[model samples]
Target: MTLRTIVVDDSIIFRKVMRDALSAIPGVEVVDIARDGSSAVDKIVAAKPDLVTLDIEMPGLNGLEVLEELDLRGIQTNVIVVSAHTSRGAEVTTQALSMGALDFILKPDNDNAGANLAQLKSELARLLKMVKAQPQLSMVSSSPAKSETLSAPIVARAPVRTTKTTSVPRPVECNLENLKTPKFPHLCHAIFIGISTGGPKALASVIPKLPATFTIPIVIVQHMPPLFTATMAKSLDNTSALNVVEATHGMPLAGGGVYIAPGGKQLGVKADARGNVIAVVTDDPPIKSCKPSVDYMMSSVPSSIARNSLAVIMTGMGDDGRDGVSYLRQNGCTVWAQSAESCTVYGMPRQIIENGLADFAFDLDDLPNLLSQLAYRAGGYCPVPPIPSTTAPMMATN
Candidate 1:
């Protein structure tokens, strides 16, 4: 199965380089190349290739505008943004994700062209595999008009609950009775989310829909680079009723706030003397090739916290959160996965479901309400006992 592909870039050299790289990947055919955005859009709408490598900084009709135009015209195709490492590039790449690109690869800045192309080729291959595995590639426009932040009521969809019997758990009937009468008298102390590919758009759909009065402290590890995570956090904060900020060391993990783990650092939580959980940012090495890894963050969750936390594994390209989720579930944490139909890449969530670690799985539209309900109705607001200072001393973890 040859994946028809297009390379869209202003640089003649990069276009050729990308073409050669794509050719090296098995089953990828370079159907066409466009020198700029207008030509790229025209060629795309005409050829309708299976994949496109887009350069975000085209001279006219930049990559973002091209995505907007495609959304307006209802064109369906997988797009991988080839982006520079500049601040502007990071900002626009974040926007591109929210606008519905499947994923992105950073343009290597090193002068060694061979090394750069090798990295690009590896990243592109991974993203292509993710795109090919998706059951559906068509997507609705993520523009403001179609955004889920409006007052439209979300109709409940039945959640997918599974129990381990074999290697991969088979879905059983959703038992609302079981959900309501869990062993724990309440839902959770905190909500921890792990997402990667297609995360920005998904998070945009969820975080803003959460009511301002909802007070559960939500911590997120969205696999991204440094500047990219900060930019994404700012974007979410602008639209969200809940205060959203990039997690910093010593920051209090309090209610009514959403903390995004900083991109290049490991984020963990430790209880302060005042009983409030505070952020712990460390220069730890990457876990499973991901800095600020979901595993690292969730592993840092204390047993007291884990026993009462809800771990959400959403759309992503890899199984970074699986081990962490395993630990959490073992400690009595409840786990939820975003359903395949709602995920851009079902890799992460599928692992949870397959490993029998998921307590529930839901569509993107149904999650915000479910989270709010469990957080508010299930006695999630029990306040932490007050202590002295908001900050806590960082502790070393083995």
Candidate 2:
């Protein structure tokens, strides 16, 4: 299934560079190129290509306007935004994600053109592969679940009813009997989420939906570069009932406060002398090619809190959280994965699911309710219902 692609950029140089990069990626056919947003829109509507690599800044009609125009026309083709790492670029990119761009790539901000192009090709190749995996998805239509939440104010809802988990796929090495099915939600102390790729959009879907009465410290490692994560944190803060901020070094983790690992730095937690777990931002090298790697943050979980922690692996492009999840599971932490059907890129959650590390698999829309229930359970005022269990046995996939 070759992806019919178009490169839309005002700069002739970048247009050529993108075309060349796409041409190198297998199964990507650069069917056309547009020099500006107007021509891009015209070509897109006419050709109906499978994908478009769009530049955020353009003369006449910008990328955002093009997206708006596409939405007005009801075109749902794939769109991967190409942006610089500047403050303005980051701001618009975050907006683009919320406005339904599939994903984004940072343009070269350094003088190393060769290295930059190489990095661009690698990232583009990965995103393209993710796009190919779900042919039916588009930037405009990737998250149909968000419409309801977007239209209506997020209100507390009834607990999710029991659903048998027998349909979930199990990896061959995991033994269901050996798995610890303890009632860990009642003991949960903190929530750590690892997300990437479509994280901004996915987070927008889940975070804002969390109940206002909920009061658990939530930490997130959304794979993003510098400036972008900060912008994303601010964007999420505006809509979320909880206070959301970009984590800084030595900032104490506060209840009901949501902390996002800053882009370009590794974020982890360490307990101070008073036993207060605080966010630690480090200039550590990238792990699994992710500076703010989910594994890095999850590995830093204080042992005392490990058993009482709940780790969530959401949409992403790699297995950054797998090792960390394994560590948490060993420490008696509960792990939940976003259902593949609800994920924009199912890589991160798929890793945990395939490894048999996940205790529960839920759709994105189900997560807010599940978390609300867990928080309610921890409060001990009401008897929280148990998570749905597998009624019928599942065979491990070979």
Pairs that clash in candidate 2: none
lDDT of each: 0.79, 0.77
lDDT of 2 by residue, 1-398 (tens): 67889999999988888888899898778989999999999999988888899998999999999999999999879899999889999999999998888899888765888777888899899887778765336533233222111111112211111212112233547554443343346566689999987788888988999877878889999988899999999999999998999999989887788999999988877655555667878787777778788877887775556677789999877677777777777777889887777887777877787678888777777778778888877882221122234322111111
- lDDT digits (tens) for residues 1-398 of candidate 1: 56789999999988987998899999788989999999999999998888889998888899999999999998988898988877888889989999899888998777898987888788888777666555566422221112111122122211111222112234444543333222332756688999998999999999999988888899999999889899999999999999999999989888889999999998987666666878999887777778878877876776667777789999986777777788778778988888777888777887777667777878899888888887767665554544456444333443
Q: Which stretches of candidate 1 lie over 4 Å from their true place?
A: 138-187, 385-398
Backbone collision tally, model 1: 1
